[model samples]
Target chain A: MRSHRFYTPWLLMLPALVWLALFSVWPAINTITLSFTNVHQLTGGHYIGFKNYWLLWHDPHIRDAVLNTIVFMVICVPLLTFLPLLLALLVQRNIRGIAFFRTAFYFPVIASAVTVALIWKWMLDDRGLFNNLLQTMGFVHKTVPFLTDRWLLLLSAIALTVWKGLGYYMLLYMSALGSVRRDLHEAAAVDGAGTVRRFWSITVPGVRGTMILISVLIAVNAMRVFSELYILGGATGGVGGQDVSIVMLVQQAASGSDGRLGYASAISVFLFFLTAIPLLFLTRLNKNNQEES
Target chain B: MTATTAEDSREGRKRRVRGTGAVRHPDRKGRSPIFDAPTPHGLFFRYLALIIVLLISIGPMLWELSTSLKSKAEDVYTQNIQLLPHHPTLGNYGEVQNTIPVWHFALNSLTVAVINVTGNVIGATLAGYVLARLKFKGRKLLLGVFVATLILPAEVTIISKFQMITSMGLGNSILGVCLPDMIAMTNVLLMRNAFMALPREVEEAAIIDGANVLQRMRYVGLPSVKGVLSVISIFAFIGAWDDFLWPLLVLQSPDKLTLTVGLSYLNGQWSHDPRTIAAGTMMALLPILALFLILQRYFFRGVAQGAIKG
Candidate 1:
C-alpha cells in the first residue's frame, strides 16, 4: 500500500533530479554534439564533420598528454595499489595510539592537492631544501632543475600523487580488512604459517575484490590527473610545455575568450571513453556478484 | 591462546547482542581485530613501522608550518633545515594577506563550502529517503540516473556544466562554483544506502499508526542516518573548501578567488617569497585539517557500519 501521496516522492526527488538532468545528463549528451561543431567562446559554427578530431589527431600536445598519462598510469597503478594495502596492514591492529597514527597518515589525503603540490614545489625548487641538502652533502656541486625540467617535473608530480593517495586507498583497504575473518588468521597461525604467509594466503584473498576495485579507481584517477601536474609544472606544463595531462589540455582549450569549446568537448568525449570503460565493467561485475549472492 | 579467548569474548558479545535485536552499537564493534594477535615479538616491529609511516606522512605538514613561522632573520634555505623558527611570528601570515586578499579569498571559500554542505544535507537526504523507503513509480530508474553518473568522470562533464553555468550568467560568482557540486550523486547514493540499512519494521509500525511519509521520515528516518549525514557533510565541506580547478575556471576577478586558487595565483604570479607562500598554504590547510581531526572517529564509525557496502 502507498503510505505517501502521489506527489510526495517526486517532491523529494526534485532537487537531485534537477541537478542530474541539468549538469550531468545534459552535459554528457551535449558534449558529444558540441564536439562536432566549431564553437568557440565568443563565436560558433555548424557541424564541422570531425574537423576537431582531425586537429586532435595531429596535435603534438595531445601526443605528449597521452604519453605522459601512460607513464603516470604504469608507475602509479602498481605503487598506489600495493603500498596502501601494506600501510593498512601495518595500522590494522588495535594498539596504543593507533588512532593518532591513522589520523596522521590521513593528513595528506585530506589536504588540498594545490597545497601539497605547492609544498613539494617549494622543496623541489633550485634553492629549495632537497637541492641545498644535496649540495651540502657534496653529492651535487650544483642545484637540481626539479621544477623546470620536463622529466624531473613529471616524476616529482607522480611521486606527490602517490604520496598523497596512500592514506586514502589505505582507508578503503582498512574497511575491507575489518571484514576478513579473524578465525581464519588464527587457524593459519596454528598451522605454523607465519605472518607474511597468512597475509599472502588468507588476507590477500579475503580482500581480493577490494584490491581489484581500488586498482580500477587508481587507474581512472591516474588517467584524469590534473591538479598535481598543473601546480608542479606551472600553467604552461613545465619547460617545453609537454608535461600536461589530458584534463589540463581540456582546461586550456575551454578557458579564454578565444576558447575552443568544441575541441575541448571533443577531448572530454574521448576521455570519457578512456576512463569509463573499466568502471562500467566493474559495475557489471558488481551486478553479477549481487545476482549470485 | 589469547587470540582464541579474545575471539570467544567477541563472539559471545555478538550472540548476546543478537538476542537483544542484534542492534550493534556503532562504537563497540568499530575496532575489528584481525591483527590484534599481539605477539610480543611483533609489537616492537609494528610500533617501529607505524612510527616510520607517521613521520613520512606528517613531516611535510610540520615543515610547512615551521616555514610559515620563520622570520626573515633566519636563513630558511639552510642545508640542515632549521625546523624551529628563531623569532617565530605571525608576520608572514599578515604578509600573505598583504600580498593577495587572502582573508577575502578564505571567506569566499567558506561561502562556497557552506552552500555546498547545506545543499547536500537537504537535497541528498530527501532524495535518498524517497528512493530508499517510499514506494514510487520510476524509483529504480531514478536511482539508475545517479548510478549512471558514476561511469562518467566529473572532468568529462566539466565543459558542459561550465557552458550551462556561464550561459546562466552565474560565471565569476561563487554560486556558479557551488551549483554543480551542491548535490553530489555519491552523497545521495550514500544516504540511500544508509536509510536502506535501517530496519523497516519500526517504520512499518509508524505506518500502522497512520503516520504520513514526511512524519515518519522526520521522526524515524533522520535519527538513524546521523553517521552518514556527518560523513557526507565533512566530505562536502572538504571538497568545496579545498577545491582548486573548478573555482579557478569560474572566477576570473582577482577579488573573487577561493583560498586554493588564490594561493596558486600567489605561487605563479607574485614576486615570489617562500615564507609568504608557505604561510598562505598553512592558512588554507590548518583549519580544515583541525576539523578533520575532530570528526574522523565518526568517519571510521560510519564506514565500519557497512555504509560503503552499497
Candidate 2:
C-alpha cells in the first residue's frame, strides 16, 4: 500500500515530466551543445570549439543588434512600467462607466500581435492614416517615411509594442491597485494631504511589489521582442537591417540560406544569459524584500 | 441671562449647520455620495482623461476598421483624412477571402489552438493535482524546475526544439507546432495554485468512498478546478492562436500555415493594398474580440490571480 501510494503520484506526474523533458529540458541542453559546432542544415557539423563565440565577439551586426535591443528595452521599460499604472489609477475610481474604460484599455491585450502589427503597419505607412492626418493638419508638407527610415521604424515598432502591452500591464496594475486598502487613502485625506501627495505617499508605496514585477516583466519582454520587429521590418530587420533585435539576429542567422546553426545557437545562448541575469537579479531583490518584510 | 445666552448659541449652531448643508448640497439634488457623485470639475477632468486614454488604446484598431470599410472608390492616399468611411462597403472582407485562403488559414489556426488547449488543460490538470493534493517527495524540486522553465524565454530553445521536432518527422505539421507548447509551466503552476486552494475535505471524502487516485481526479479534482481549467484553456487558446514565430519556423507548406503566418505571407503578396490587409486583420481579430467580450469578467479575474501568484 505504501509503495502504491508513492508510485501513484509519480504516475500522475509522468506525462507532464515527459513533455517538459522532450521539449524544454532536452532542447535547452541541445542548444548549448549545438552552440559549439559549425552545423548547417544540409551538412552536419563537427565540433568547432568557441569559433561561433569568437565570431559573435567580432560581428558588427551582432553589436548593432545588441545595442538596438538595449535601446528598445530602455525606451519601452519606462513606458510600459508607469503608463499602465497611471491608466490603472485613472480607472480605479468608483466613477460611472469605469468598466467600459477598463475593458477598452484591455482590448489590445487579447488581440493577436500579428493583427496589431498589421494595423500599425498600415497606420505607419507613408500613405497611411497617420501620415494622412499629419499632412492634412499641416504638420508636415511631405509624407514622412515612418517605416522606411531606421530610427522612425524602430520608434514605430516600439510604439506598437507599448500600445499592445498597455492593456496587459494595466490589468496587472489594476489588480494590484484593487488590493490596496481604501482606508489608507481616506486616512491620508484626513491628514490634509493633497491628491498628488496621497498618491505618492500611499498608492505608489502600496503597489511597490507589483511595480517591481512589472518592471522586470517589461524588461524581459523587451529583450525577447521579435514579432513586432519581424512584422514591421521583415525578416532582415528594418531598412539596412538597423532595427534587428538580438532574437531577430538569431532568427536571421539560423534560418538564412547559409544555415549558420552553430552561430545562431551561440547567439541564443548569449540571449539566454542576457535575459537570465537581470531576471535573477530582480528575483533576488524580490526575495530580499519579502524576507525583510 | 443664562437662558438667553443658551438660546443665542443654539441659533448660531443652527445657522452654521444650514450654511454647511447649502454648500454640500449645492445642486439641491440628493445624489448618492457613494455611487454617481463627484464634483463637476473633477468629473470633467476624469472623463476627459478617460476619453483620451480610451482613444489612444483602441484608436489604431478603430482606424483599421474604418480603413477596411472604406470603398476602393475613395482615395485613402490623399490628404483627406476621414475617421468614418465615406461609402462603407463589405466588399473588402469578401475581397480578402478571394485574394487568399483566409478561412483555410483560420481553420488551421483553430485546429492548432484547440489541440494545444486540450493538451495544456489535460497535462496541467494532472500535474497540478499531484503537486497540490498528493504528498510526494521531490515535489518542491519539481516545482522549482517548472518555475525555472517559466523564466526561460522560448527564443533560447527554439533552435533545438525545431531540430528535435524535425528529427521526429513532425515538421511542417500542426503537431510540430503544438508539441513544444503542450505543457506550459505557467499554466501548470496556475492550476496547482487553484487546486491547492480547494477544500481538502472534498478529495478526502472521495478517497473514503473507495475512489482510487484516477477516480478521485475525475470525480472530485476535475470539477473543483473547472474555473482554472477554463482560465488555462483561454490562455492556451490565445497563446497558440497568436503564436507567429513557431508556426512560421515549423510549418513549410502554405496550406499548413496558421492565420498569423498566412497573414504575413498575404502582406508580402499584397504589399501595397492596405484595404485588403486591414480587412484580413479585422477578420482575424473578430473571433478573439468576441471571445474576450463574452468571457471578459473571467479573463480579468484569471489574469489578476495568475499575475499575483505566478
- The model with the greatest DockQ is 1
lDDT of 2 by residue, B1-310 (tens): 9996697568546655645644344342333232223546778999999999889889988999998999999887776777899899998999888888889999999998899898898899989988988887898999888877877798899988877887789988988998889888777788888888879777777777788888888887787666667778888898888998888888878878889998888887754578888899988898988887788777666665552333
B1-310 per-residue lDDT for model 1 (tens digits): 9997797668646655544532222236543233343656579889999988987888888888898999988888878767699899999998988889988999999999999999999999989999899987888887888888878888998988888888899988988999999998888899999899879899999999999888888899999998888888888999999898888888899999999999889996873888989999999999999999989999778767655522
Clash list (residue pairs), candidate 2: none
Model 1 chain B worst lDDT window (10 residues): B18-27
TM agreement with the true structure for every prediction: 0.92, 0.91
lDDT (10s digit) by residue, model 2, range A1-293: 22137788888888799988888788889999999999885577889999999999999888878887788888999989888998888887757888778888888888888899998999888888889888888899998999888888888889899999998888788878877766676556556677889888898899988898888888888888888988898888887978888888887776744567788899999999898876888879978988998
Poorest 10 consecutive residues by lDDT, candidate 2 chain B: B28-37
Model 2, docking class: medium
Top TM-score model: 1
What TM-score should be assigned to candidate 1? 0.92
Query: For candidate 1, what TM-score does chain B get against the true chain B?
Result: 0.87
**Clashing residue pairs for model 1:** none
**What TM-score, to 2 decimals, does candidate 2 have?**
0.91
